[model samples]
Target: MKKNIKNKLNNLKASDNYRVRRAKDSGNSHIFRFKGNDYLSFASNDYLSLANDVRIVESAKKALDIHGYSVSSSALISGYSRSHMLLEEELSNFLGQEKTLLYSTGYQANLGVIKSLASRGSFIFADQLNHASLIDGSILSRANFKRYEHKDVKELESLLNKCPDSREKLIISDSLFSMDGDFAELKELEQSLKKYEAKLLIDEAHSLGVFGYQGRGLVFEYLLNKNENIFLTGTFGKSLGTFGAFFSGNSDIVDYVMQKSRGYIYSTSLPIHTIEATRASLKIIEEEDWRRDKLFSLIRYFKNCIKKSNLTVLESDSHIQALLIGSSADAIFFSDELMKRGIYLPAIRPPTVEEGKSRLRISLTVDHEEKDIDYLINILDMISQNLVQ
Candidate 1:
């Protein structure tokens, strides 16, 4: 088994698709340290720059003083605490949902929700570009699974039309495409769901704390949260600057998932300190409009800068920006050149993205200044020109 693993790794290295972890000595806001050198990072998902906020840290410490870290068991057993219930209530109110349930991570939330809701005789219509968790969940559900083209509502509707009305239909998609940095058309999707009497499950991992009023995410922004058929899931690790994830829906759905989700029922609850820190982050997300304002401003500025350059960037209204570099080797080369100049933008290759569509995944945070964006544009332009020559 060890020899076979080594051979597989060798094949990956030859294909220029092998991945390795880079240890960071320290990191704060938009900067990270590696090998004793600090670099401006465009690889983080900390969009609101709240990951290292003093208040959040202090709140976690306070929780630690009171709760002493580990819950030690799953929520169904002995791990569920008053603090967890309070956070769930707060999230429910904020998201305009009847109830909310916490999970260890975004991946677990997606897997649990899909598997719990879908089974034999059920049909899961998923977007082609949905996250791996969603894909895996659909496979594990043992349901009739079908994937439609990316963001093509018409194609989704056509597929739905072909399905039998007797079976349960669940439509799953990412509210924001993580790699492409584009939004799913929730309005059109909701219409299709209503027409077919299908249920909707959306993963808002990249949308929460970044889009919508009070950072409630794209569902609320599009008024889809009021739709009883809609179920929303989001992660705290991204914009919330903490850990864990949540699944929100009507009371019945929440209760059903609580009883049925194997992932939530079997795994230990998140530490109390992390939940308290997330609470602190949620408070800031609701009250601080200036953070969103600054982030959107930076996004606009970055897009404008890219427009003036020769780089081919995907259309995105969110914080994630993808600059296409065509091949895995070219994408890595571009990322390496930027790292040499004190910028840390990572190259995203298959199967994270489609083959021959490898690119640099640039994540912008509110902590980044206009000048930092300017520097990035210059570096990217220079690298692209040199590569062309």
Candidate 2:
């Protein structure tokens, strides 16, 4: 067994797809220390820069003083607390959903929801470029699943039309594609689902707390929240700058998931302190609109700067921007060159992205300044020029 595993590992390395963890010595809002060197980081998902905020830290400390780390049991077995319930209620009200159920992580939420709602007779229509969690969930669902091309509504419509009207259909997609930073046309998707009388499950993990009025996410931004068939899943670790995730929908769906989701029923709940911290983060998201505004400004500035360069920037309006590098080795080389210049932009390669589409997944945050953007653009220009030569 060990020999077989070693052989596979060697194959990965030869293919330029081997991954290794690099330990960070220390870190701050926009910089991290690795091997005694500080590098400006554009690889983190802390979009709102609330992860290191003083208020959030203080709130976590207070929660820790009141309730120590873990609940030590599943929510069904005496792990649920008032903190959890309050946060759920707050999220439900904030997202304009009838009810919400919490999970230890976004991956688990996607797994549980799809598995619980779909069965042998159901049909699941998924987008091809959705996050891995959604893909895994659909496979575990034991339902008849079909994936449409990325953001191709016409293809999705054709697939939906082929399914029988008597069968239960679930349309699943990420409101914002994580790697590509592009948006799924929510209006077109909603219309297609409505015509087929199918249920919609939208993963708003990237869009929440960064888009829409009061950070309601792209679903609400496009007025899809008005549709009763739509369900939403969001995480606290992204824009909210904490941990855990939630599934929001009508009261009956929430109740069904709570009672039937194997992942939720079998796993321990999120720590009490984390829940409290997330509540604090929610408050910051609601009251602080400047964070979102500044992030958008940085995105615009970065895009405008990239327009003059030879590098291929994908069509994206979100905080995430991918500069296509085309091959695994070249992407890794580009990332290393940037790091050598005191900038930390990680290479995203195959399996995380498609083959030959490997690129640098730049995550812009509120903590980044205009100078940071300029520095990145300058470095990229130099690298692209060298690659051309």
Candidate 3:
């Protein structure tokens, strides 16, 4: 037993990648108290900066008062609440879907969708750069999995042509890529799916409340809102700045998952307070369009600044901006130096990205001001000119 574990542990240590934990004080932005120094983070996925929003917090508190704490059992086992039902209804209306099914997390939602849909002989066509959750879910489905080049619908068409006529096909992808900030070509992909008569599953983890009319998502933004064979999975963790997740589709599909998906059936549901806060966050996204505008403004400014510094900015037209630093050591050093100057963004390294492509994944929020962008620009310029050395 000792010998069996020793080889695996030793391999991890030898890889220059021993994972560790650091405590963070989550109540503030630009003020993570770790190891006696405050660091401003760009690593968090809270894009709208609504995690600490006063109204959301108050709504959560009110829900706690009304609903109390523990959801002592699964939703099927008496854990379901009025707030959960309301949120599900609101999501269905917002997404223009016939129904929605809530889950404990985005990861679990992806798993449930794939495991339930992709049967033996079914084909799962995926984007090469899709999130790990989608990949894991497809593998777990016991289906014939095929991956195409990222955002290349032509390649996807070719793959679809090759599949045997005996099996059903499901194509899965991210609406907005998590790391690269690139977007899927929705219209083209839809055309390919039509040619093959395949079902589509889109994970809108990064795009919801960031694109489309009233931030409904990329699906609505692109006028693909009424596709009957399309399915969508989204999370409150990103733009909504809350917790939990949901999947939206035709009423039949949603009901089937509700009755059959093991991930949904086995797990306890999200707390009442979390559901209430997510509801409040969605309300804010609907009524306040200016936040989306402000985010785009900052994105444009940052891109212009990155260009002036002569740094390579990857081709991403979304809120995520990657400044390629090449080597992991250089990326790590650059992140550390920025922290020393009271600016913080982590170096995304191998496994998170392809080797030799480590980068600084700078994310913008509605709460970040023009001045913050200016400061980041100055620091990046200084680093490029070798001043940080």
Clashing pairs in 1: none
Q: Using TM-score as the measure, what is the rank order of every candidate, best first? A: 1, 2, 3
lDDT of 2 by residue, 252-328 (tens): 88899899999999999998989989999999999999999999999999888888766668999999999888999
CA lDDT of each prediction against the hidden true structure: 0.93, 0.91, 0.86
lDDT at position 189, candidate 2: 89
Given candidate 3, what's the lDDT at residue 378? 83
**Considering only N, C-alpha and C atoms within 3 Å, which residue pairs clash in candidate 2?**
none
What is candidate 1's TM-score against the reference? 0.99
Q: What lDDT is obtained when candidate 3 is compared to the true structure?
A: 0.86
What is the lDDT for 27 in model 1?
83
- Which tens-of-lDDT digit does each residue in 293-321 have in candidate 1? 99999999999888888886899988999
Please name the candidate that would achieve the greatest lDDT relative to the true structure. 1
Cα lDDT tens digits for candidate 3, 264-356: 999999999999999999999988899889888888887787777756778887889888887777787788788888876878877878878
Candidate 3 or 1, higher lDDT: 1
